[model samples]
Target: MLAPPLAAGELERPLVGQSEAVILSLCTRGNRLPHLMCCISIDEIDSLAPRRDEDSSEGKVAKISVLLSVLEGIKDVPNLMFFSATNRLHMMDEAFLRRMSGKFFVGRPSSEARKRILDKARNALNPKILKKLVVATTNFSGAALR
Candidate 1:
């Protein structure tokens, strides 16, 4: 259900041609790399493969085609796995969603969880400030707290 996060620059916009190669390499690197296995986590996946519609451009269509082909090619790979996260799942391509093995939704942290996150900075913040921060960060994500 999880894979290693990728470097920031790898997932930049205009994912048209570049993503296909990145996906292929990550899935096929098992043979060349010492681990004989590889995994990737593509954040904001919707930007990479949005649903095709009447307004879709040629480059967009081509990108989706290549992405689907790459994914299909790796379906039988035993040592490769990929996971992705997106806040806007509805904007993603249906074909792309169909390829996912499972889906999970993670909500914002609870009060205690928020306090725990603030505890990490306890050395820098006094007890009064930490308490205020927990309340201020209500409904915040773990990443936001960090």
Candidate 2:
């Protein structure tokens, strides 16, 4: 929906079916997309841009093309950034990966990392118990520990 434009009276109604035009305008035209952070999560990498063999819908392919173009276009624009987090890296399509300028892997914490994590939370536990807990939490995330 065109919530932003509709509120500002740019358009009388939402541009329901003009996705490509809208995306292109947002990327290439004026300061329609503000200079800010855009963090997103696509849980199923395969679903968005599945392997060509696994995808048959023309709409999906078209969507992939449009999305890639928009992302690739505005990547160098100052003060604009997109942060996407996905756990299913292996399932991501090659085109999606190719569009990414940098890729970082955040795996489970190592022993030193775990120790540092525990050091901040050692007030409630004995030293021996903290050591045991750190070892036992070998694969837990920072959020899980918190």
Candidate 3:
């Protein structure tokens, strides 16, 4: 599941209607460049790593096993790097956390940071309007501000 999208973009690109085998060979072997893998909105990871007692299906177990196997056997795939994001982290399963090499918590921005963003946006308003925008956008991300 995680591996497919890594090559999806490359394969989807219009390379004069190249075959999947040719594209895979080019991405995995033709060049020496590293493959950048990313998976966003990873909130459903618990379903992927469901507990044995929690109505886990055979298909889920198989997928989880394959994902873990791929993650564990990183050496087999040359220069493979992965990243993921999630908004609902409290619901995450402990077993999945153990497999992660690192984790980062990007919380809400500070007042000063918000002000700087507003400044970059060049909002030609007085203090009151600026303050309102900043305070109202408590949990808003930088991208959302634009």
Candidate 4:
């Protein structure tokens, strides 16, 4: 179910996306399963443990401590599936990375992939002028395209 946007004075609610829905459904179906699964994306991890620069002073250790506490609260769970991604994999704390079990780097697309993506974007645009617009937006990310 889609939630209504927040009003002027209301506190913002965390938006639940399709992944959250799928996880909920799985939990409902396997009520007896004694397993805890966590899937934290790289973007989320970065937000939680941002670099200590001029803009932010919080350390990565503090962030990892909080995450560990949350995981510890979960009841007996034999099977754990934790997933995380990051472009800056080296920046993450060694302890936190170990908990992930596996790490994968998702590099920017190659020339061929970029060309294919551009073509697909051009096709999706209405009117012939969209092709030119897509061409103008060279080297933009998928999110930027939207």
Top candidate, metric lDDT:
1
Steric overlap count per candidate? 0, 0, 0, 0
* TM-score against truth, every candidate: 0.73, 0.59, 0.54, 0.46
Per-model C-alpha lDDT, please?
Answer: 0.73, 0.58, 0.53, 0.44
For model 4, how does the per-residue alpha-carbon lDDT over 66-87 read when each residue is reduced to its tens digit? 4443333343133434344455
**lDDT, residue 121, model 1:** 51
- What is the C-alpha lDDT profile of model 3 across 35-128, one tens digit per residue? 5542322334554454544676555445445445444554234454435455566655455566677888888778778878987796687888
- The sequence of per-residue lDDT tens digits that candidate 2 reaches over residues 6-36 is 1112211244335445444544432445555
- Residue pairs in candidate 2 whose N, alpha carbon or C atoms collide under 3 angstroms: none
Error of 2 at 30 (Å): 7.6
Candidate with the greatest TM-score versus the true structure = 1
RMSD of each candidate relative to the true structure: 4.0, 7.7, 7.9, 8.8
CA deviation > 4 Å runs, candidate 4: 1-32, 35-42, 50-62, 69-76, 124-146
Residue-pair clashes, model 3 = 0
Scored against the true structure, residue 46 in model 1 reaches a CA lDDT of 83
Candidate 3 accuracy as TM-score: 0.54
**Where is model 3 more than 4 Å wrong at Cα?**
1-53, 74-78, 119-124, 139-146
Higher-scoring candidate on lDDT, 3 or 4 = 3
For residues 1-146, could you state the per-residue lDDT of candidate 1 as single tens digits? 34468643464446556755565556566556646556667787787789999999876776566667656653345565667788998999999889788889999999889888879856688888888898999988898899
